[model samples]
Target: MTGPVVRKCPLCGKPRSAEHAPFCSTRCKDRDLMRWLDDGYALPGPPALDEEEGKA
Candidate 1:
């Protein structure tokens, strides 16, 4: 059987249409940009340690 259809927009969790296969619409795409600009999203990474860097 075919894998579960994964045709939803990653930014807005809406079904992706042919015109905007990865984003429901241009608006949703812009919304994702705004979120980035406003720091609504975050990246997972290791925390900085002063001791490791011989700073403390």
Candidate 2:
């Protein structure tokens, strides 16, 4: 019988480790970090106005 849905690693479909949490291994973890550093992820929203620029 199915008990519950087990959470899988987002980087790869593998069992998650206690240390890595969401990622399967350090490599996947590092890869995810690199993606963020390279602006691989972003949020959609209107651009915020610069308060200082408004004063000028």
Best by lDDT: 2
Model 2, CA-based lDDT? 0.88
Q: Assess candidate 1 and give its lDDT.
A: 0.83
Candidate 2 — worst ten consecutive residues by lDDT sum? 4-13
Candidate models: Cα lDDT each? 0.83, 0.88
Candidate 2: the clashing residue pairs are none
Summarize candidate 2's per-residue lDDT along 1-56 as a digit string, tens digits.
88867778898879788799888899989999999999999899988789987786
TM-score of each: 0.57, 0.71
TM-score quality measure for candidate 1: 0.57
RMSD (Cα, Å) for all candidates, in order, is 4.6, 2.9
